[model samples]
Structure formats: structure tokens, C-alpha cells
Target chain A: MTEPGRQGTPLIQLRGVERVYGQGDARVVALGGIDLDVWPGEFVALMGPSGSGKSTTMNILGCLDTPTRGSYRLGDLEVTELDGDGRALLRRYTLGFVFQGFHLLPRVTAQENVELPLVYQGVPTHERRLRARESLAQVGLSGREHHVPSELSGGQQQRVAIARAIVSQPKVLLADEPTGNLDSARSHEIMALLTRFNRERHLTIVMVTHEPDIAAYARRVVHFRDGHIERIEESS
Target chain B: MLGNALREAIRSLGRNALRSFLTVLGIVIGVGAVIAMVTLGRGATQAVSDQISSLGSNIVFLRPARGFGPGQSIIPFKVEDAQALAREVPGVVWSTPVSLRTLTVVAGNQSWSTTVVGAGEGYLEARRWEIVRGRGFLPSELRAGVAVCIIGQTVARELFGADDPIGQRMRVDKFSCEIIGLLDAKGQSAMGNDQDDIALIPLRTFQRRISGSTDVDSIQLSLADGVDNERVLQDIRLVLRERRHLSANMEDNFRLVDSKEIERTLTSTTRMLTTLLGAVAGISLLVGGIGIMNIMLVSVTERTREIGIRLAIGARAADVMLQFLVEAVVLSFLGGTIGIILALTFSFVAAQKLAFPFSPDYGIVVIAALFSGAIGIVFGFFPARRAARLDPIEALRHE
Candidate 1:
């Protein structure tokens, strides 16, 4: 167990983690035994083919799924064996998710989408609005708070997703294929914004992508194939 | 949480305005049917009592057990029985022995068929009948069996027309009778019969002249003031039993009908019919509740990603359940409120057309609204649970 308010410790740790779906003869392994540690203020990239188990690892790290076997610790909390509500609380206070589709509620304004986390935390309405506005401004969306997902371009919508991810100031941000749906120009723009946040705000960002240019923006890359990590590379 | 839920519900409803309206229509119709059936039932009951009271409180009807059935002799009731009851009952204010027969009445060149009733002098007091002109038949004329008659408004209009009907002669089949008196007009009965469309004559004279029998069809009885009806009825029943030589175990051969008993029967029948109508209308509410369940399930499905998003943020499963539950309840409550308003408006217009007083019980309206809300809770549970149990990843992945 890690003590609370500790500094200079890893933000996330995984030891011999394994995830299996189904049973008996029909069983499929999504993740083989693996060990990894992610320190604070680091940006890592996970690259793999389809069914290479990278997405499964991301899902587990995001608190959306539990590993069948292994010890997984998120900051000071042991999350591998957390109950439904415990996992929910871990997701609330520790993790934020960015999906490939920029899953912003279509009917709500960008500001309202960012305020959703505060709403579940029972924050006051006025304070929630202020914090959401601040997050949007921080993401370079100062004048776009009222625009819904449909009204915004692909890059703008992805920025809103990033704003939503960091609005609560979580310990880690897990983005699955963040730039997968954008054109090259929009993709580069999104990556630049992510790079700036990592350097300026010192946020720990773990992004999954197969594009070499997208991976080049990350400080470290972990390559996966056939349900196992193949190599680790330090990008220059 | 409440604000977000309310905003989301409003937005979702706004998104599919037609679907929302269609979903609520069943609830509206159900509630409207309940209000309409109950209101009209109460109004009909009130109208009946009003009409019955207008017939006066002193009148009582007596008929034989067979009740003037077809193919039965009209001489079942005896004039002697009426005389015996008049002499024996303690609260007998007055008794009118009456006999009726259908006869063709002829005057001058015109003739029409009408009912002729043979009644004693006390019949005027029993029926509250007033003489509009001329004078009543004398007691001596009744003893002498002189042929005299009192004509009603309709009979006078047919026979005398713009002229004085008193002192005129009219033919009853083969006999000539002088119209000694004219009766005031009485309004139509609730059953649409004209109360003043007949003629009255001396009981003895008619028994000898037209019926050629000494029997009376029935007798009218008027009771004294402040009389205990149950006691009087028991006393009358006892006397009639003795007069008819009825055994202790035998049922009375005559039916002594009272105004109160008739009122009770009519009110109960109206109550039963009202309940039946209300039950039929209540089925619509059940269907409406099912409609709410169906819509709520659809809503939960439509908002799957929203539920996942809220859950992913920190919302407990119970919180998600409560939001959807509240939304369903709010939808049903809105439907109930609108339905009540519409039903009241319909009842107002209907009351005017029916010529009856309009009044709705707010207690019933509130109860109905609460009942609809409960329906929402019961029906909304499954969908709310389904929403709460959604996998955040799969839900976020949903289109």
C-alpha cells in the first residue's frame, strides 16, 4: 500500500497483469503477463495491430475493466480488485478518458460537456460553470463554450474532449486513438495541443495510436504484438 | 444531479417532439375517460333526484304484486281494499281510489284516443291537482252516479279549443259526460310522458259507466306530517296482511311502494352504473401506464451513452436509476395534469348541453394524479435498472 500525499512515486504500476475473456476451450487472452510503471509528468504511446491487447490494457488503466490476474495499483489505491462503486470512485478522482470518437454529448454545449464530471461530484452549479469555462479557456476554446459537438469541427471537438478529460485534474489521462478520426491537418493540430499540455501543465498522458507521426510526438513508445509487449523505444 | 436530469429530459423530449407527444397521449386519454365517466355519472344521478322531487313529496303509489302484467285481468285490485286501508291506517291523511282504462274521447267533430282515470274527491289533494276553472263534482253527484269529468290541459285543447271547457259535454265511447272542472297543466315526466294528458272522473261513476266492474286498479296515499315512515309502513303492511288473509310465512300479495324506496333503488342503480363506467374508463389508465413503461424503456435505451457518461464521471448506480425514475414520473405527472384540464373543459361544455349543473371534485383529481405517478414508478423500475447496469465502455461505444 502506498501512503497518501506521497511524492516521487510512480503514478501507476502494473505487475504480471493478465486479462482473459471467455472460458475453457473457447477462452481468448486479451493481455499476457506484463509489468510496467508510469511516473508522473510523462507522456507514453502504445502502438499495436488490431487484437494486440493494447486497447485492453488502456481499458484496464482507465478503470473501465478489471484484469483477471495481477496486482495493479493506481497512485495510492489498489484498483485491480475494486468493486463497481470503488472502480467508479477511482475513475472519478484518479482517471480521465478520451475516446477516438470525441464522445461529447451531442445535445449539450461544450461547456456543459466539460462540467459533467463536476455534476457527478455534486459541485455547486455556479462553481461548476466557472471551472468548466476555465478548462475550456485553457484548451484554447475561450469563445466556443456554447457550441455543441455538431457545430464544431473535428479538431475543435477533440479539443473539447481533452478539456473534459483534464477538467477534474485527474492523476492520469488515457486516450484511445485520440487522432484516429481526424484528417492530417486536424491530427497534427490535436497532437500539438496534447504536446503543449504535457510540457506546460506536466499532465501524465498515455495515448494509443498506430500512426508513426502521432507516435513521434510521445516521449516514449511501447510496441505490442500478439497479446504481448514486443519492444520499448525512447523517441528523440 | 436534479438540474442535469431535468435539463436532459427536456432536451431529449425536445429532440423527438412527436414521439414524446404520442407517448403521453395514452395517459391523457385514460385520465380523461375517468374524469368524464365519473362526472357524467354524478350529474345523471343528480338530475334523476331533481326530477323525482319535482313530482312532490306527498304522493305514494300502490300496485298489485303482479304489477299490471299483460294478459292479466285489470280487476285484480278491489275498491273495498282501498276503503279498508283508508279506514285502518293511522297516518292516512287522505286516500284516492283510482281506476284507469283507455277510451276514445269525442267532442263536436273531432275525436282522439286518451286515458280516462276514475278517482275520488281526495285524489285532487293526493296529487296536488288544482282546478283552473269551474267547480269540482259534488258528493251528492258522486252518490247519484251522475256522469261528470274533469279534463286535463291536453284534453281541453283537443275538445274545446279556445272556448271554455267547463259545462261542455264530451262523449266517452257510448256515454255523454259533462266537464265540470278543468285541471292546471303539469310538466312532462322524466320519462317523457305528459302528466296532464288525461281526464279524471268520479270513481263510482266510472266503475259503473266504463269498466262495468267494482274494482280499483290502485290507490294513492298521502301521509300525515312528521310521520315515521318505517312505523307507518309496518302498520300498513300489517293491516293489509290481515285484510288479504296472508299467512305469516307468505309474502304480501300487494306491493306498497313508497317514494323513499323508489328513490333509494334509483340512486343505487345509478351508483352501480357509475362504477361500471368508471371501471371501463380505468382500463384506459392501465393502458396508459403500459405506454409510460414502453416510452421509459425507449428513453433509457436512447440515453444509454448518457447513462454511461454520468456513471463514468462518479455517479452511483442508484443515482442513475433515480434520474430515469424521476423523468418517468415527471412525464406521467405532466400527462395527468393536462388530462385533468382537458376533462374539466369537456365536462363544462357537456354540462351546458345536458342542462345539468357542473362540479368536479378536486380530491378525485389529485388522487388520480398521484395514482398516475405511482404507475410511473412501478412501470419505470425495469428501465431505470437497465440504465444503471449499462457497461460504460460499451455505452460510450454505442452510436
Candidate 2:
């Protein structure tokens, strides 16, 4: 494992990224002229009102969508205009995601959910299980190995989703409203767990949320409005 | 990735157990219907072929051609024509002239109107008639025009009961004929004729005593091995026309009919029925395939959020498509296996009760299964594409 603070290279670079939807008279801009850089071992938060393009930025950052115009680099690969399959390949190898609802597959056990990313990576079964178990243990879910999402509480389910996101040891971890569905205490617990994973494992974390308290947990906060970035704040 | 997709599909099916079972039910009934129809058709074809084969192989029948209808003119078959058939045709094994008429026979007190056919020695072999008791007409008995006849089991039962029928005398019209042989039971024909309720006698005796004429109604011909019926029929016709002194342009006063022609017609009819049944079954299989597609599409819709999550976590579009396609295939294949089992059960019961040869061809089963899988792929594609092409944010937003 690499050291947490030594994020030696520029892991992601974006310049003038724009995403437009529809066509002709119906054309609307979802993301416009955004420039940003995200490095490894960094916890960043993107905050905005609904329809302010925070989700669009998160999507572009996650490689789930491409910008209509711009140059974007994920690690060493230029990925802004990658085809569907190439983008999928990038997601498989270099990214892991946690969604707002915990997004834990309801029927699978907690351990199986943790093992999902490694499945896409084509890791052998025994190795995947071992890594998934270690991730679950790291997230304080060792005894809940066989528990399904429905069997666990909101916090435990979010921890399982976090475990899934980190299991592949992906280059970047993107969390979209990871604690949006949890209570305040559970939200804090999820944030603490995510921060620990970022600090201890040196995982790059990009979280999207509307809560200022959630954004405060990150080292940097980026605010967006009306499809454009408004301001960026750095805190010790 | 493939494993995850499979595990997810299985889990989804388990979660919605009732819907899944109902979807599978459609496939089950469709496949079952196809197999049942096909099996019945196959059995019918086999039964018909067996019935035809039960009749004598390489046997031909010739009927006298009257002026316009039966009993109009007495231009019936003659012994001369029968002799000419035996001597002239290259592959002719034997020929026998026969005359048949219905008459009431009285033995002790029992009386029954049974078919009494007059034939020579060759008729027994030519018609596949078996002797269960006594002996067939001997050459001396035939030449002497002795009033000896063979009785079928049905006739014997109606007249003799448990008593020995051989050497018993029965009154036919006014003359008495001694029973010389009893033919084995032959059951019923497709035309519903009672084949076993008949009596056989020497043609000479019938011509001289019973019918009061030397004219035969029909001539039965048996050919040697490897003789083609078409060529031999042509030879028989040509020889008979020349012997009868009929002009080439004139219509023949005799009809030479090959039993093989009847065999061909029956076989073609059976084939037609088989085709019709198979086509109907094929429609069911197609319906089963469409059911699979419909279910798969619903599955795609229900799993959109899951698909979006997978996409976010690094699944390729092709992966999404393959997952759903495999699910559809699994459902169809399972249905096919169950259908084959059901078909076998139906066939076994039908064979046991109806005595038809019920056999299911594994080749057809395999073809049906393959067809089902192909349908799954074609139909599962659209929904799978929808899942793959989903906007992750929009999908996550879906309620």
C-alpha cells in the first residue's frame, strides 16, 4: 500500500469541460466550462442545490459520462471522449463508487456486496473473498459478513457499500450523497469511516452532498450553481 | 463480472418469486404443448406404417373391370389370366384367382353371414393369411374341386365355439363344405373391415358349385424379391390386353392395382398430418420464446437502478446485455427440460392405452431448446440495451 499523504502525481485533470443535453431549440447545458484537478489521497466535496450540476460533475468525475467538449485525464489516460466500452473499462479498473441509498444489492450478503468491484476486475474468487473480508473488517463489519442489506441498519448498510467501493483498491473513490439517507449520527459515523479509509489507505475521495457539515469533513469544498462552479474553499 | 450478473439475476428471481414462477409457467405450458403434439404425430405415423407393413409385402391385387359398374357385365378374372401372370411376368412368384361373396353358414344350430372367398394355393401366401389349425387346400383337393374350405377364428367362434372346427361340415347355400383350416385372427382394417370373419375355399370348387360360373372376381399376385411393382404391373397389363385381344386405344377390361400404391397414399397422408401437427407445436415454441423476451424486458426495467449501480462500479455495456441474455436462456432451457419430461409422460400413457408407438426424438427436443435460446437473445437485446445505455444519475434518481 502507498502512503496516505504522498499523492505524487496528478491523478485527474480537467479543462473547459462542457456537457449539453437535447438539441435544436430544446438544448440545455448540464455542465459548462469547468476546470478542476483531483489528486490521490485527497478528500474533496462537491456541494450545490438541485439541478446546479453537482451530480453532473460527479458523473464526469466517475467516468460514467463524457463531457460534450474538453480534455480530461484520469491517471495517464485521456478519457473525456472515450467510447462506452472504453469508459466502462476505465470504471472497472480505476474507479469505485458509493451511492446515496447505500446501493447495496438487497439480496446479496454484506460480504458479497463488498466483493462486487473485484468481480468486475476479474479477481480470482478466493482472493476476492479475502480482500472483501479485509475491507469489511476495515469498515468495522467483520461479524456482519453474511447479513444482507435489508438485515442491516442504515449505517451498517452504508458501511457495506463503502466496503464495496474500496474493495478493488481503485485509484479513485467517488461517493455521491453517501450519507443522504442516514440520520445525523449515522451520517457522521459514515463520514468518519470514509475519512479514516481516505487517511489510512491513502484513497482519493470525491464526495457529493448538499450538507455543509458533510462538506466540512473534506479538506476542500467546491460549490456549484446554475451549471458552473461558484467558489472553492480549502481548510486545514 | 459474469458471476456477479448471474448471481444478481438469480437473486432478483428469488426476490420476486411469484412473478418469476408465473413467467416460467408460460414457458412450461408452451414447451409442453409442442412436445405433446409432436409426440402424438410421430406415434400416429408409426402406427399407420406398422398397419401397412402388417399387410403382405410385395403383394398386388387385380380387380376385373366391368362395363361401367360392378355386376354390370361378367367380364371377370379367369384362371387363364392367373396362369398367364405366373408364367409370363419375369419376377412373378405366384398368382391366384379369387372370387368373394357373402353367405350364411350353418354349423350345428349357429348361423352367421360370413365372407366366403374362393382362392387357389397362392392366395394364402400372397395375402399374409396364417393357418392356425389343419391344412390349406392341397393340389389334389384343388384339382378335384373338393368342397373343402378354411375358416377364420371369428367364423369358427360363431359356428364351432370350443368344438374342433377341422373336419366339421357346414352348409353354405345348399351344398356342404368340410372345414380344412382355421386362419389366425387378423383384427380390423383401417377401413373397419372384419379381416378375420371370412372363409377360404378352392376357386375351382366355387366356380363349379357355388357361383355356378367359371369367372373370378379378382386375381392376387405375389412377386419375387427385388421386383419393382411399377414395371411388373405394366408387364401384367400388356400381357393381359394382348391375351384378351383388346385394341391398344381401347380401355382395358381389367384393373391391375399394386398394393404399394395404396401404401404410398397412406404414407403421404400420414406425413401431411405429421407436418401439420409439428407446425402447430412450433407455434407454441415461438410463443414460449416471446414469453421469455417479455419477462426479460420487465426484468430490465425492474433492475434499472441496479444496472446503474453496476455501471457506476465499472460494468461494460456488453456485460449488461450478456447478463440478461443468459437469464433468458436459462429460463427457456429449464422449461425445455421440463417439457421433454412431460412429453415423455404423455407418450408413455398414450402408448400403454392406445397401443400406438410413442417415441420422442431427442433431436427435436434439442432443436426446440436451441430455438428457445435464440429467441431469448433476440428479444432480450432491446431491454438489455436500455439498461446499458441508462444515464447513471437519472437511473439512480428513478423511484
Best by DockQ: 2
- Give the chain B TM-score achieved by candidate 1: 0.80
The best candidate by lDDT is: 1
How does chain A of every candidate compare to the true chain A by TM-score?
A: 0.95, 0.95
Q: Which digits, one per residue and each the tens of the lDDT, describe model 1 over residues A1-236?
A: 22122268788888988999999998999999878778887889999998998998898888888899998998888997689889888777777888788888888899999998888777899999999999999889999999999999989999998999888888788889999999999999889988887877777889999998999998889998877899989866
- What is the interface RMSD, in angstroms, for predicted model 1? 1.7
Tens-digit lDDT string for candidate 2 (B1-399): 666667666766777777766776656666676777777767766766666555677778888775443555546767888998899898888898889999999998999999989887688888777898999899998888898989999999999899999999998877899998999887765445778999888888888878998888888888886877678889998988888777766677777777667767876787787777767767776777677778877877787887887877877877777778777766667677777778779877987787778778777778767765666677667767777778766776666
Interface RMSD of every candidate?
1.7, 1.6
Q: State each model's CA lDDT, in order.
A: 0.82, 0.82
